[model samples]
Target: MRIRQRCGERARKRADRGPSGLSLLPWLLMGLGALSHLLGGQAPNPWIGAAGLLAFNTVYIAIVFRAFDRSRRESPLTWGLLVTLGLLTFGLAIGYGREWLLLFPLLGLGVGAVVRRGRLLPLIAFPLVVAVGAVTFWRDGWGSIGIVYGTFISIMVTAAILALDETVRELRETREELARAAVEKERLRFSRDLHDLLGHTLSVIVVKSEVVRRLAPRDLDAALAQVADIESVGRQALTEIREAVTGYREGSLATELDRARDALSTAGIEPVVRRSGPLLAPQTEALLSWVVRESATNAVRHSGASRCEIALSGSADRVRLTVTDDGRGPADGTPGSGLRGLRERVAAAGGTLDSGPAPRGGFRVTAELPVEASVPPEGDPAR
Candidate 1:
């Protein structure tokens, strides 16, 4: 029962790994060859020779299985057994006939598949086995037919097994590369979220902290209230950070617009926001909210403009957000990392974001998102 369970687990693992059925073909053919030998009355002691054939093929299958297990160290004992089996099969073929000679080259091929260091051995061993069979049969009155058949079978089997092995190795390497790419993608996402979340939150904290410092001596109560607000904002930032880590945090377009206005006011800039069209889907709204936050943050911190205008208007199938600030346009002809990261995010959501100097003056950030992207997933709580 334990052996059966182990076999079942192995089968499941093989299925999970890849379409590895090709590797089994060689073993099935070898088994069929053994069965043919037995049925054809080629062995003098049929039962004993059949048992020997089974034992050799079993060892050959084991060696092939070991080739796939990189974690397990290659056992020298296994290679020694292969050598011993090949010699024994050669002796049997010399005493009996050419049919037993096939097993000798088969043993060498199994060894070659497992032994990564001695790749040349199988090349030499297969041809030698064929040469020996040809010489023995030619001397025994059997002619070129025996030599050609032995050579063809030995070379074909060895080549087929090695080809299959190489294919499996390439597939495994490709899977590993894909896994690494997935990990890198996840890391980028984490960094982007942390930056978007903390950048705005920290900027607000700095502004409010400055407000408290200014009011501390002149207005004690107002300073104390500002300190309290700081504490509340810090706590909220902590909650949002935690949610962002778990990928559950959602944003609101209305909330972001209000915060953007407040942040602009604190920075001594006038913020004008206008919205039109029906309400957006939750995810789309959240993404647009992030745009507002990022735009407001950049306007306050980078752009030295005194006035910023944000316009949101689109049809039933689309939403457009245009943020324009009359600031010194592009500096050194490079967009900031914040905008670059935002571009990636927008693109992932099947949207387009264009940011550059406005023709009339200042800088402009315009984003257009599909209306369908706003729709929540079927089972989403927000839906």
Candidate 2:
């Protein structure tokens, strides 16, 4: 599968080169036809010389038809008929007189204008036709130095027009690529935001609903409180989703710690928090906040734990967080959705998170984040 994909990519790149390659074909045909004319002049038999010139013109006309067909704007059969007409004109040029040869280049220009239909085509073809006509007139004893000067001007104009066409094509392609990249970036950003907003809210709602089911017949007030907590959680989830959509979502370590405390207290588990960290980068802080929330949640929902601890410490270069709970670890022998999301968030921030059973008799989670202060030296002592 991988090999096939690589081959397909190479083919696409080769196809993208077609436009520039086709642009060079007309000039190559003209150069080769001119060479054939010169060589025919040296042939021993006049008939053989004429036949050689006819063959060269025929091949050039065939090439023009193929170029038009590849463009797909014109019908291949129509261009093929045009090629036939061009061949007849070449024959008439030879039979009528040598002066009639001047018409061939002009005919080529007319065919180019019809088939190419681009602004650059006329600009390139017009001058070449006039120059060929002037050269033929000079050969027939109607020459002037002004005709040669005009030919040089024609060549320069043709080159300038083609250069402009190439520049416009490059600019259009660059704009398309940039637009595609922006769309992809926005898609990824939204996906991450949705995950962050909905995952924990849904998990908490499920846990509370289960608890309310067990306590409803025994204690009506306790069931009502659980229902209220569910409503509050739902509202908070809606607010976070709105903020995420509006690019206004922000998180802090202190706020997450408070929530963690409340969750543990409600679960009848003692939660101990120890902090000794400098201010964290926004990305690191947000990620650590999510970690704290997920750890506390899993401790309540999955583990039958009596105690939990969350510890945070940081210096100038590195920060570490550890969450431990004394519980019967991982009942089903599979990690839950909360743990999976926590793993992804930490990994994305260039940090690591490990969660498994503690050898003594519980579950343990540890995370580390690296931070770099972006302030320049002596920028401001107090800002």
The C-alpha TM-scores of every prediction are 0.60, 0.58
For model 2, how does the per-residue alpha-carbon lDDT over 1-383 read when each residue is reduced to its tens digit?
99999999999776554344245345435334444544656424556545545664555445544543345325666456555645654554444434345435434533553345457556745665565555446454454343334433433443454445546666768988988977665565566556545756776787778879989999989999999998998998898888777665666789889878877776778989999978787767767777787788778777889999999998888899999999976788667766675676566566788988877879999888776323211111011
Q: For candidate 1, lDDT tens digit of each residue in 67-142? A: 5554431677666666665565556556556555555456545544554434665675556656666555653545
In model 2, residue pairs whose N, Cα or C atoms come closer than 3 Å (at least 3 residues apart or on different chains), thus clashing, are none
Candidate 2 lands at a TM-score of 0.58
Which candidate tops lDDT? Answer: 1
Backbone steric clashes in candidate 1, count: 1
Clashing pairs in 1: 281-374
lDDT of 1: 0.71
